[model samples]
Target: MDSSEYILNAHNKEEFPPAHTAEHLLNQLMFRMFGAERSRNAHIERKKSKMTFTLDHKPDRKEEKAIETEMNRLIEEDLPVTSEMVDRDHIPDGVSLEKLPEGASEMIQLVRIGDYDVCPCIGRHVRSTAQIGRFELLGTNWDEHAKSFRVRFKVIP
Candidate 1:
């Protein structure tokens, strides 16, 4: 697991899949909105019922607003979220496949949001964007060194 902390979602399968998928979308959105990337040690604590990520930059209110808009749009659009089997060798050049937590098998499953979001993922998510329901930007803040920004938010189904 490369030593990064791992945790379980507070909710069971049904609740966790959508919430966790939203978190992954948030992770991708932040990257697109800004050049910053998410931390490899990222996790969504379903039990804690909170979603957070470590980022290289903190978005000001304006940026957060834009992100909130983009994210919610993604959920509302409910783009078809699909996955399939792919050979480990077929993984795209820039994507990282180093940490396939617990149940993720060597065959590898990848999730795609519409045509826009595509990455290697083991977590469950809505089959399409429509199932994502509505999303709101709860809040965000810069952590200790400004080297990381933590975002907390949720999706309303």
Candidate 2:
């Protein structure tokens, strides 16, 4: 979750706040479920978004549906989202630094979705998970050669 996405939110661009926040939560959910890291590639947008993760094998339909169910359950929990600034060196373990873009500040702002997720990000997010709406996994694709699976999702208000 250590990435420039959060900081990029401050720029007041066109990215949707709720969707962006949900992306963070979804990313963390992937990590929790599969012990996999965040998406190696992502394209988060208002209407729909996609995230690609490296997995030993692709998940079955049951697993994919489970992901959607769990994600929506978390959103309905209405957990609070908070942010705090911490020194770069003080970043907690399990947070990856690979996505931090160039020219990032020494102080990183971490966006926390309750106790579920705490990652350095600069994107705009909803104050609570309830604002994230229902998470729907629209589709999935697998690449055997790369051992990668991509999940496309959207939020239903």
Candidate 3:
């Protein structure tokens, strides 16, 4: 379909498209590696971003390095980022509505990063992964009590 057929919701925040797009990649990577759900909390900024995921165990240094490696690999793949508007009732398989904000509209925008990842989102994003620059994992913190793993990172352009 044409771009005119797709409607995007009014975004509350003006995110740095590159960083925001990187967040999607990170979320998908976390899921694929640890079977963890997408981050429940996230702060995406131009210079730095953080995402918190619930996991059964903390990822060691090697695993952390692998996350960075895989993210860069995907970025280097230069996948196209596209989106479509879909009815809530007809949401595609593997797409979850659990992360949708409260009072969201019935028409949802599904953002797809090539064949690597797809999710319902209304945030700004780069047209392709090549625009994301380099993925850097600055640090991480694991809260044993909460089972929360918070990752701090940024992209170097």
Candidate 4:
């Protein structure tokens, strides 16, 4: 048996949608800018929430700021978000997969932004990116050797 369980306590559905979705944008920017990959993600369910994740590598201050800026711009653009099913044998032209997740069935769910990020995901997202209403990633610190980072932030009201 597993020694521990990762549990998320969402008081209400209202607390999670936007913040979790924003993580996707941050994930893409980190990969594109710093060649970092998300190592793990744990989204907590509670009021005054916090979600933490790690990266393959640490990002510098400049890159981190750029990530914050670009993400906000995208959210401001209010990019339309949508998803569809694609055959596993058929990878859509031009679309990219960050990492091949195992145990995926024959068909994959594709979550997309008009001219932004596109990858297979099975998570909840806002109707439009803009709904995220500003991005804030708290306590930007990471250990290169450990390959770990802790980010605790919530959406702006």
Candidate 5:
């Protein structure tokens, strides 16, 4: 079955399977690089996606490039994109529940990218990392008042 089937909702909105999955991978990468929180806000779409992270300072060009490079490297690794439903009590440590919406079910769906990342997600994803192709960093923005760093990106075939 196509991976796209996992992400589409009743609204019939177009959700790129690769992009949605890549967003999850990128969030883990950002956490490793900056020790900051995972995306607090994200706009996941077919054309492009944006995620916001709260950070003390903005990332420089070199860091931004590194983010893109690492994501691509992981994508090229061909890691399996797998998911399973687990009781909330079994949710592992270090997997944040912040992204989950209010009144989320006790049975959570966990998505894992090889040995790299694991998070509770209900979105659709490709069967493997290779399907993600390449990752591109379009631009970034920092909100001083909110102390939030926003990154815009896209996945290329």
Candidate 6:
């Protein structure tokens, strides 16, 4: 479809593209490793970001380190990041509409990171994975009762 045919949601925040892109990778990684859904809450910024996921059990230290390692590996792969405008009625398999805003348009913009991840998004992102600096997991907190795992992280150039 032509550019005019695409409808992007109104993004209120000017996010750091690298960090924003990393959030996508992290979300995909979390889903793959834990059978968890993508993070429903995220705070992406230039210096740091945080994402919270609901899981059946908290990931231990070894698993957390593996997350960092895997994220960096993906970034080093220099995967291409691209976006496509798809009709809302024909959303691709495995692409979830759960995160779409209530008033999202009929034409949705889907961001894909190589073959690793794809989701409906309107935020800015780097054109390639290598453009995202090193992925670092700074800390994590688990609320057992709530089954929530929150991770704080940042990227280094």
lDDT to native, each model: 0.65, 0.85, 0.92, 0.64, 0.83, 0.91
Best by lDDT, which number? 3
> Which tens-of-lDDT digit does each residue in 1-157 have in candidate 2?
4454434323446678888888888888998888778887889898899999988888999999999999999999999998887777999997776788777777788889999998887778899999988888999999999989999999876
Give the candidate order by descending TM-score: 6, 3, 2, 5, 1, 4
lDDT of 5 by residue, 1-157 (tens): 3334344213335568899889888889988999877787889877789999988888889998999899999999999989877676898898877767777776777889898899987667899999987898999998889888899998886
Candidate 6 lDDT over 43-105, as tens digits, reads 988887999999999899999999999999999999999988888788999999987878888
Single out the weakest 10-residue window by summed lDDT for candidate 2: 3-12
Stretches > 4 Å off in candidate 6: 1-5
lDDT of 1: 0.65
Give per-residue lDDT, candidate 3, residue 131.
96
lDDT of 5 at 134: 83
TM-score of each: 0.76, 0.89, 0.94, 0.71, 0.87, 0.95
Ranked by lDDT from best down, the candidates are 3, 6, 2, 5, 1, 4
Query: Which stretches in model 5 have alpha-carbon errors above 4 Å?
Result: 1-14
What value does the lDDT take at residue 131 in candidate 6? 95
Looking at candidate 6, the ten consecutive residues that score lowest on lDDT are 1-10
| Alpha-carbon runs more than 4 Å astray in model 2 | 1-13
Clash-forming residue pairs, model 1: 9-46, 9-47, 10-46, 10-47, 78-129, 78-130, 79-129
Q: Largest TM-score belongs to which candidate?
A: 6
lDDT (10s digit) by residue, model 1, range 33-127: 76556445444544323444555556678888888888888887768887765657888666676555555554656677777777776566778
